[model samples]
Target: MLPALLRRLPRRHRASFFRRRMGAPGDLRRFLAIIMMIGCVFLLYMFWAQPTSPTSVPLQTFVPVVTSKDSNTHYAKIDFRWTWTCENKRCVRKESTETGVHVSLTTCSMLCGSSMLWPQPTGPTTLGSHSVSFDREQLTFETTATEPARSYIQYSFAMFNSNVANLIQLQKNEPSATPQRDFNKFIVKVFVEHSDIVKLTLSTDESYKLILRMEGENMIGTVTANNFFGARHGLETLSQLIWWDEFASGAGSLKIVKGASVQDAPKFAYRGLMIDTARNFLPVESLKRVLVGMAANKLNVFHWHVSDSQSFPLVLPSVPQLAKYGSYSPDMVYTASEVKDLVEYARLRGIRVVIEVDVPAHVGNGWTWGPAEGLGELVMCVNVQPWSLYCGEPPCGQINPDNPHVYDVLEKIYRDIIELTGESEIFHIGGDEVNLECWQQFRNRTNPYVDLFDVWGNFTVEALKRVTKANGGKRPKHVMIWSSNLTKRPYLTKFLNKTEVLIQAWGGSDWTETPELVSSGYNVIISHVDAWYLDCGYGRWRENGGAACDPYRPWQTVYMHRPWNGDPVYRKSVLGAEACLWTEQADHVSLDTRLWPRAAAFAERVWSDVGTKSIYKQEQLSIEDVYARIQMQRERMIKRGLKNEALWPQWCSQNPGMCL
Candidate 1:
């Protein structure tokens, strides 16, 4: 009892007691030093000797193998051989023939095992630094996990239901050489006695140092997903979805808020948000992060504007030179496989990607190709010097829509695009701004220069449709054109009368100022440019003039804009909203700042049941809350190497997103 009290006493007081008892100064000093050293060693030993975990569960990346009685394989025999340095610690393994097989290895230094046909085998697998072997019909795996044991015995049930061909294919496509980089590291060990219905005793542990053991009738051992990083968050997000097949949590069984049956689907069948890679190209990794953000917001459509007048991003198989002339870099084109990878990644997150090759007007090839050059008959020389800007010479460039050969060129390009993007039902024939001046200058040489509508705009619609439909595939379902067409009257009637085209009503929607196109029985996407455009960087009131004053929109403006203002009955025309970032003068430096935090609001507006308000008034609400969230998001963007810092200004107006 006296020793225990002394041990419990404060160390300084104990030392004082020692000093007082020792009397001699030098002897007391030496004795105190020795006592202090001994105390430290004892503490360190106490920590080190506190029983290292007895079991080691190694992560193994396993391929599914199937065999049936019809194949005359004798119960698929398995042989396992394991070699480990036990280091004087007892290494023991328990195995069984019943309930398939169970094996557990116990040792202080290392626990290692090799076994055959264990644990209801048809299930998912995890990969790590493990070695597995199979010969004749015998199988073996040899590995040792850490002392605290952080690994899993992922049971594979699909093996029983697979054919020989599937087995062969699975074997061929084994988990990556490094499984830790692929599947997350996890472990579970369970001990049961006698009856399957009753759990007499159970034990569980994790790398996070969480451990539990119990004896009960019904038992469940679950590891809450770590809010860690990388593929783990992806796994966690997927686990929360309704359709996740593997490890899907049953209703009320998992830690979910009760009374909340979130039977929700996306509002629009197609929620499209475009990134203009043509004007200001972004690297693949940058685009991938954007894709992840898109997934988070439930925005399904990735309208990748891969090409335009500025440059092309697709590597044309038929016309490789086109990419050379159009791309920013010598080889700046997305390979076929890369496009497939993007598609598959998007598909996993319930997103569909649509590629847009804005043709005829936007692809100003004539500017670079020059006149007298045979570029789909689109370039024309104003004078003797064919390529000159003006030489008493002809201004020789601009696509001549009247030419028959022009249609043939487009047809070839369309075929190539189709092959690259798989099969998209809608093709955006960008008929936005053909500036009549381009046609008026080179008019007589191309077509019968008739009325304002018929000569330039009307002709291209029919010609483009003809060429697009000529391909063997199904005719594209829809074509997207700017709302500028409605302002251009009889020409609008020409295309509107022919096919069902969706008009993107993006001129700026106002409660008082009604749009002629929206009222004219047209299915309109209410993408008002003032509110939703993300490309217009912050600090634009000074740089680009006040009328073009596009200070980066904060959260409130995005969330509160009402789609249907006038009448609820007529609101079906309000298909959905799209947040576009037109890269007129955008780069990686300022893109993420303007688009994010601001875009997060638009996402909430579209996905959540957040109520609405007048666009002007919405800017007045306290957006500071959203700004805090934005700061967090901005930090993430920066960490991911996004150019978000360029968006921050040295000083900003207190009421941002408000019109002065």
Candidate 2:
């Protein structure tokens, strides 16, 4: 089309016609072309003359700019002149300009400040007394305690000395070590204030008053408590109070302020951490490390989920075949001696070890000893041809509640457990997910009178009786069960007594189960799976490959949980809350990282005041403050040989406001 149109006009006439139509004639076009060439040359010249580096200009006069200093830091502004190059068609020249820039200037050296305590004290803590310092070689401990606390005092001192040695080693080994003066000699005085020595019983008092005063060269630290347990708590507080600081000289020194006083006690009687060792057997050493971590956080109850459908690792002398046939390996079992040692280890750290032997539901391994050993064919075989009649999971089984031999075996197991872990007043008879279908299937093969409820209720009742009878008529203070036992079958209450059975409300369709159980006239321990189950977010145990729950719970979510949110009327029935770690996806390698920091959140919630809400909201303690404390606590755990996961990058921890 264009060619045809151009062909219609003569070539010479087209040029004139196009030039006229285009709004420029010969002289104007030539003048415009010259202007365009000059502009291009000017731009090229400017590009060539551009400075490769920033230009600096000297100040004509010394002018000081003042800035308002904040208590946190100081800032300053300075004005200076600089030369900038500009090019045009006519000429190129440099111009000097004055401008002010603001900068933060250090007014004083950054020094270490007082550190915050973890599982922060529930009572008042005041600082205003004398300052005390300690050197690794000069520290000494003395105890003035009642006869009952002598052993505890000795143990506490040993732990304190060990911690001191660890801290010194950490400071020396750390890459950022600083030099400071060698600390002075200090004395720690432990006094049992109560006249009558309290035995280390289940009802032992754990409240304590600690006063640390600095008196000139000699620092006097006193821990006064009513019982040995309280004194142990005081010792933990003393350890937390002592922190090391790096001086400008680069040397590390330990110090405790002279006039600091702390009167503290746990908000709940049962601040617990439930560890499932049955899924992935944790060695005795790993279990001890867990206790140490729990002790550092002041968690009192170590709910040892010792057995499940997968394995039974606790060695029972009466039921020797259980561990022999069920454990992952012979070495994986916790022998009777090892159990005692672990119990004592936990006792020394002021933590009670509660053994959990999940019966009926999670007892596939319990059936391994065979009917020859008086064990019944109580559960349908998982590998049986007709899979529809068996348990939910492939290769799973429940204890045969109908078989009289099941009770006999339970009696022996409970007796052995009671004899082994002597101090614990509570035992967890896991009554969760009993698989009524399995029981129904088995019932078709037996008498009709023995239905699922009858078997379960009778088994639970008999087990409770056996535990009490085994304990020399001194029934365990509480035999805890899962919420499903009571919630699903309220009629089971007739067979189970509220005074004897404590309902651990967990794995509910919703979080309302705790309040519902408490309102139903039952003592409850809130272990809501959504909020307190530490193992959920990791992943499904044996699934194809996916997280068990979406949006893995962060530490903040764990911190926000309040066990008794719905009803205040049954709050007293709420014994406490526990953080459960089901180890389907967890083993020794990933245990510490998976549990700590997040579990610390639950620890604080259970130990702090009941009214303490979410840290996100403005309360007496802010979330930022808690974050700082927890970060510091995480470091302390690492120093104490706990392989806790880091909460944030080191830069964020060192520079507080940067991350927030």
Candidate 3:
């Protein structure tokens, strides 16, 4: 058909028609050819410039820059809502409508809304409604401290450097955490008033003021403190203020309050948490984790119940036989360097490692090497049959104070503790739960005229003297002794001196001992077993287990425990408190769960003494409000690599008001 048409046309016309039909002539053809040539060049250049992998593609192609109209709606009123929710049994992002359990796009972040912070920072404090977003990479810590304080400042800075990326809960694609074309820097300027101070003591001021403001190009965070210790607390508070905003700029990112102020100080100087490593030795890593958790809550004291009847994991070179014979195994021992390193680790985090070697009573397994090396009866009735007859629990052992050599052993132990921890100002002489029957048996058989009570009282006196001698002949400013028979009434007067001893009450708030100890002018650390003991509540460990301190002390019990709720004069004897976690039924496997959330409750009780509507106003907030704060803290701990137990069901957290 085409040939017939072509034949019908003239030869000259046919050639012209062919060119026009097949390609187009002159300028029209030139335009089409130029377009194709440009397309080919673009394809070739793209292939050459880009690697084989497709990752180099700009983020803008997928995520458009969210302007005022396109910004993610975090709440109906505010630009952002910073609540939280549960995920994988820990608090992850409180969940946006899509990724979390909000169940709808309207659930505002209520987790940090009222509480805003944990361990409830004491007032004058205020939380604002506006928000500011930033790249955590820009987070910087600059300190005005000099010399020794600078060491701690650097340590805290390094910790943030190694950890700021993890502060936000990043996930697959984690696009929000990616480098952004639009993000601001955050600078933390710390002004320490006492820059020359570096020591961490019970009396050390852990008070700090944190002021946050949005400057021209960066979010300026100012921390003013009396020393490095307080400055470190301010850092922890700063970390708390930043959170993952799942609904930021239509893409999840980290955001902090644009304006905020916190003038905070621990209510008590002796805010502490005690972990017994004797029953079960915790490795350096585990103890470091403890320090991290303590730092998070502003707890300053690490009362290391280092050795007890079960084991003496601390290897003292002067008394090598203690660890050789007493440790669960040689491999499970804490060497001198390990102790020093751990002490430094705690110190850097603003925590004092107060080493405690429980004296006469809890001194069994660790002292069995006496006669083997010419030290006569260093410990009495070690692992004796019918253990309850001698000590409070199994594997009965007690230091034989009757033996003159025992004082020498105690002195060496004290000396090593002071050297290893560099903590000679305070010490815990574990003198709790002594079985008078054990002493009665030994003394009655030996000298019948010696009163068993007097022997116990005399043992206490001798131990303190040895400790004073060990501490360069200067008595510790505050010597800690557990609540025990010897600490009651006439015995207390005969053995312990009020000027020197700080009694740690561990019986129960209901007991008269708490009041009696304070009334007697002995500075007391309230650790009532019913309130502050974290190791209780797990039924029983033995075949016939039900201990006196059972039914588990929950976070509420800890929060409301104020044994010193009296006049200022009576309270004068009430030095802070320590939450005790005896590892009889707890170990590394359940360490975090046992202490946290609850220990944090104890922390607030002793730190701010406020778990209310407002730390400053001290308004009446419900237990539900307190629970919410704990939940937030628990999640923060999880993000920081702590394995805390669940505060409530995920359902309870997701639907906060409904659960209550």
Candidate 4:
């Protein structure tokens, strides 16, 4: 009786009865109600927080350069005006167009229809009716539409603009009260074909017209510029647009897929190639042909090795004799207009032209002065009796930096180079291979070891700064030197701060053996010869009885070689990589034969992920097949009336990689 009574009371005394009741259906209903409330909150937050995809709405842009009533539009010029709105209000914005009109010039301003350019009438001028305008970030062409003989017109950005930066900012911004921040998608539409007259229908499916669409909530672009074009036209055109439809379908010798679009951008910020013209004196057209190949692979920077131990092609405005005496031809030097044309061509392709005037060491025969204590025929002593005349003999001249006049000559030459190249920053003044032995031999009896080497290097730096400052400021300029100078690190450190310079580590044989120079706190560009040097012939050549040292590098080797062997050197400083074409076995014809197909491989390696392990992932092309494609493109260059096109190998039965 007591136990029964205790059990009945315990259920009441311990509160077990209430707790047990709570664990039943009634409690489960309450737990499910709480869970449903949490789920609702989560779904609501997701609905408000998630980003939207880029808008699918069609956005078309066109910059019509000409609309002539005469029905003959061969030479007719029309300025382009184009624009698009962002569906992703969060994206930043930037853009450029080509209308063959220099809006900056004072002579041709009539078409502005706004304050973008001052009004002017000159040189195949456009009348009032064909005016263009940019209003509220929208580009409008106010010309009457007509039947154009040519169905397509195209243009590209002439210079780098802040539009891309703006687009980025816009994309990153959250929805706010601001007009630009109210959206989620970014859409850019470009028109590939159009009639001279406005049509009722502007769909992409039209026979004579097409639209390229790109949409992104957040977008980034990688741009490349070559020193040869210095204009960055290929990138600009890719950034903008170019149409070859004026030529017949086959006449243009190019093809595009219908309704095909790509969200394309560069993998690396700088994709570059260097050509040593000093050794083999190539024609200007040769440079253009090389640029054409570079553009195909999206290579941007063109490092022009204009001067070396062999010669100097630039005609300094201050000192005209260099062009007359130093160049391959009297009129063969790059004229101001010719430079502009090259710049324009490269600008169309989005390439940056970087000019290299190798100095102090490889100024060639004309710049050799100073003492000669067995400093070889090319090197001149820096100290004793440094002031000398060009005797029309070997070892003719060396600019004595201490003599003020020599420094002046150097300054003038560099300034002229800047002005001729239109003062694009990032200049290369070669300060390599100075023979201290010669300086010691040519010692002034009065001041033994007058510290001239240090003084000369210091003066060169000052001279470079002067030219760079004269053009713009420090931000626009970069001074690049070979890693061989790392051996002279003490000299470099003593003369100039390391921050002001870029070191190109190109000690092919010695560099790969060690990584000390890169780890030593210097911004280094890797061009390791054993791996990256395109000039080294491939393995098959040696198999076929070629010189053992002179192995040919097929495109595969270039595609596979890594810039760094997982060294800690990258953590300290590393700018990027460059592919060099030494002219020892190169001219115009052999240049493409050797450089092309291989250069394409280098471009891919440098631009793609450095950690990418597989070379087989790329287009599975044999060395012979690669050359065949290059030949086809080379033929296209020839049809464009380029003289250097003749330099490409016309026939090669044997595989370029295999001697057999």
Q: Each candidate: what lDDT? A: 0.44, 0.69, 0.77, 0.47
Q: Write the per-residue lDDT of candidate 2 for residues 220-337, one digit (tens) a residue.
A: 7788887777888888777776665432122345655555787878767888899999889999999998999898888888999998877888889998888887899988999999
Q: Model 2 clash pairs?
A: 129-259, 130-258, 130-259, 178-250, 178-251, 179-249, 179-250, 179-251, 180-251, 214-258
Clashes of each: 11, 10, 5, 68
TM-score of each: 0.54, 0.77, 0.82, 0.53
lDDT tens digits, residues 47-127, model 3? 899643323332211222223333442322222223454333223434234332221111134323464478787778776
TM-score leader:
3
lDDT of 4: 0.47
> Could you give candidate 4's per-residue lDDT for residues 1-660 as a string of tens digits?
745755767554645654565688789689689989999999999999965432321121122222342332233222223222222211112232443222211111111211110000011111221211111122211112223311111233212222122111111122232232212322222232223322111011111111222225321122222121222322332222211221111111111111122222233455679888866778788888787667655576788887765566666667665555567666557666776677656645545677787766556444543223222233344222332232111232344444445555666676776776654446677666555544555434467746766656675677666666556555343567665443355665676556667777776635542265555566666777776677676433222234423566656577667656545467346656788887755687777766755676676555443343323243333434334333433333333333322324322311122221
- Cα lDDT, model 3, residue 369: 74
**C-alpha lDDT of residue 556 in model 2:** 81
- Which prediction has the highest lDDT against the true structure? 3
Name the regions of candidate 3 deviating beyond 4 angstroms. Answer: 1-107, 110-112, 173-183, 249-251, 444-446, 611-615
Misplaced by over 4 Å in model 2 are 1-115, 128-132, 169-184, 194-202, 374-379, 382-394, 444-451, 544-548, 610-619
Preferred candidate (TM-score higher): 2 or 3: 3
Ranking by TM-score: 3, 2, 1, 4
